[model samples]
Target chain A: MTVAAEALAGRSARRRVRETVVTHVCLVIGVLIFAFPIYLALIGSTHTSGTIGRGDVPLLPGPDAVANYAQAWGIGGGRFMGVPAGGMLLNSLLMASLIAVGKIAISLTSAYAIAFFRFPGRMVFFWLIFITLMLPVEVRIIPTFQVMVSLGMTNSMAGLVIPLIASATATLLFRQFFLTIPDEYVEAAKIDGAGPVRFFFDVLLPLSRTNIAALFVILFIYGWNQYLWPLLIVNDRSLETIVVGLTKMIGSGDAQNEWNVIMATAVLAMVPPVGVVLLMQRWFVRGLTETEK
Target chain B: MATLTLSGVRKSFGATAVLHGVDLAVRDGEMIVVVGASGCGKSTLLRIVAGLETATAGRVMIGDQDVTALEPADRDVAMVFQNYALYPHMSVFQNMAYGLKIRGLPKPEIIRRVDEAAALLDIGGLLDRKPRQLSGGQRQRVAMGRAIVREPKLFLFDEPLSNLDAKLRVQMRAEIRRLQKRLGVTSLFVTHDQVEAMTLGDRLVVMHAGHAAQIATPMEVWERPADTYVAGFIGSPAMNFLAATLEAGGAAARLADGLVLPFADGSRAGEAGRKLTLGIRPEHLRPQTGGLRVMVELVEPLGAESLLHGRLPDGAEMTVKLAGAVHADGVLEVMPIAEALHVFDGETGRRIEPLG
Candidate 1:
């Protein structure tokens, strides 16, 4: 019996080892597949444009790294796109920060009202807001642009962000979260002499910390990656976002594209969003999975 | 401390009435427990008193001030919720001091009050810990501490001990009672547990179907239940009710199987042949010769005593509590104590008191 049990355990252990090996192999392959393009962009940013123009994309870093990046940061696409990469980065950063903060503020308050209060037409208002989820930005872009034009909000940072701030998804998530909070807390707060405003600032806001962190990371990335809306609304070169400016920097026909500078700009544009996700990764995961309440 | 009075308090949610005019006058520094089964509107009564739910037509007076229209905060009442409802992010000190801070108390006074409450609850060591870090019993202490620090006119507890484990619940129930008495705050505690109601309350308000069935001291309520409902609801291994008719000139009740049981007390004021219900507690049945024969079906030994579940000859179920172990093959004869009998009117289910 002992011999048989040991043999069975050995076979099981071998199977476990094989499973681990297979899982790691699959994960490494997945990581490479996603990271290869960014690796190529990093490498391409190090070499001269003439080297890339000659169709000799190098696998290793070249000697022209500092010069290429400095030129990209100071001059940016040289004639194809005149706004400096530094200024464009700042614009993208400001727009993304505002959009993330604005979306969270509006969603938290709206969700709080809909979840906690009993007023006339409450469900009707909630459904109206929920129904907007079916309408994506692409679908409402034209009408929204017209509204922005009427308001004379075009070519401004507010114009880029204001239209994108009303987030149905965030509001829905927050409303679901708010509903899960036990009614006992509200009763306790009421008995504790906390009015609606005090409860919101003290209890609700503190309880929503992880959720806010999670939403900030998501909304920041969403704002940073915006292309079609910013491309259409902002005509001024100074207000160009990095994501839109990168594409415009590539010359279409019969012109030598500054491939190296564009690659450097692409690498720079990816930095802020990546940094935010890394910084908030712990809270982001906890927000989705755990409830402190 | 203050007296709480709820006069003609009624509540309805869009035509469905939850509380139907519950009138109660609680004395100062007394803990009154409202006990009932679920859906009996006991929680609604507590909420009404706490100003969480507005009574449809009533006036709530705390001491001399009418607080029916006042907000919960303005009424100077603090509540301990079933879930404890401690602010999760705040430390124990912050949780206790939140109300004091909201009232704009001086910082040093807030600290002193929080410290005093923490010491009282024996949670002084856990002052800086958040609620999530505490055990269930510790969290319960923090919740009570939060209420104690407020020094409100009234303390409202909404089944606060129901969330704890059985052992923890018993321990916390005693702690809450001790604390309430020590603070000398007028309190209204609501619980569905009869044991909790019996042990913790100075007086119990037994609720039934949106009405206060009986309000009396725990012993008084047990010794003389107002109705058949209160008799059955307030006792463990509930009192067994037998269908009978009044006879012997309202001095005795005749069972369905022709067994006559005389009332040991004075005769009731009901006519002969009037339908009546006789309530006898399980513990009152004693073995006797030539008594009502019960066909023994189940015996549940409870260490010191045994509970025998059987049926009378009329097929009516009866439970008997007897001291020590008893081995009955098929039949066991038992007679109920006459003085321990409770008589109720068959139609309205109200108690029929004996005449002078």
Candidate 2:
């Protein structure tokens, strides 16, 4: 028998079907719990723009979807107090890109150094980086904001990107992943006259594509979903991101609020990160499980 | 090929010194195997020669150039690790071609050289296969191919065949010897197995406790060991040792239980009445009708011979490699006649060279 057939032969047809049924049931329940709020918001937008009560659920998508999207993007906003969700969408994309690229660049080089080089104080530096992960981000918010202000980086993507670049957790993970690679490959490359940089880019990076992809997915989602720091720094309506835009949509208090528009904006804002998750679905699972130890 | 020379090579980690001032010369096209027990610094000496590791205080010369400060790549040498460190992601062809590619050889030249080396190692069929797909012996051949394709001046092997099974290890050992002879690169092979050293190396360096006990031909080392360690380590089932003293005017070895073995030569030189160790090979001892009375403890029968492990008088251990299947009876008088016993200084455990 073939290896795949032999592996599957141990389980009976009944057991396989039973497992599939249970997995599908759990997924259905989870989808229902998450999708209910968007349904109500969408229905609230359709019913003359004020019927957001939970008792009446919409059987179909609301007709006011396009109108709400335009209003959220500030096509008909009275002033700029309501964030331009279009500009926020663009900021989220640009900020997430900068944070992803910068974090990967820094983490890759740092991980390479810590994992391979025999520099003095390497262990001490690695321990220091590891210790930073224990301090909660919330506790440092006020000081971090002041530091950002002093650096004149208070209201830009750089402001969003730089504070996120000090991530010791990502650096530690990448270093550990680099460590799992056998020293033999690096040694062989060195014996072939490969320099340190050549070893990283040529040997190490090629072998770590899936890992990089996985970390990109995770960090992109993290930067996209970030709130408190951006809320404090980005008071300008034009600079607010998707999360802050969603918060404004939820907090605005007029009786005729279009819940459908808010729900559509929320779902649209989540598209890119969700797309990243689906694209790197395999690598996300593999990389996370691989770096567990 | 280049002549590799190591002078005053010493290595230590903190207070623990492993290699103590080893000096040796490896000629071009010669295969030298450093044989020793574990932690005896054989591998350390090989690494220092390859420039993979730095010596505490030494001069490493390749041909006429001093490479003490140069890295391994600058040394223009290649090594085969014990674990067969083939790059897992690359095919056999790529692994063989990697060094040449690093040196920026032309594409055709790299392919030609890799193919030639693979063919030489009888791994032509396995070129496109990754290392994981190949078996143990195949992986070993590919590893050798990786080293010799560059026509390096020196080849350093750190127990290359240690990971193979017994039968395959012997086969690969012979193959490696043949390959080294064909390539004519000066090679330094480190192994804890004396049998591998004897079969594969032209000259053997026997080490003990960070010291070179003897560096000579394998036969010379086996026949005339410099010390008790070499004598004991070079043979299988090991050399049997008994506590004794030289008496009767240095003409004989006197056992504590009154078993006197007279040397064929006149006397044991200046070692008269001094405490000594009686060394004997198992094959040298036999069960006679009546010579010395002893009891049989156990008899292990091989297809060709039977090994008897028992005690001599005064409760010291002894072994006898006799012919045929012999059952273990209670008592037997095993006689060891003239010229079969070896005598050594008991206090220092140093071999006492027999008188002419």
Stretches of model 2 off by over 4 angstroms after superposition = A1-55, A59-87, A235-238, A291-293, B291-294, B337-340
Candidate 1 chain A TM is 0.98
Candidate 2 chain A least-lDDT 10 residues: A74-83
Residue-wise C-alpha lDDT for candidate 2, range A155-268, written one tens digit per residue: 776887788777787898889888888776776787878888777776788777778888899888888888887888886667778887776666445544455566657766
Q: In model 1, which regions exceed 4 Å deviation?
A: A78-81
Instruction: Flag clash pairs in model 2.
Output: none
- Clash number for every model? 0, 0
lDDT of 2 at B224: 70
Report how far residue A266 has shifted in candidate 2, in Å. 1.1
Q: What is candidate 2's local distance difference test score?
A: 0.81
Docking class of 2: acceptable
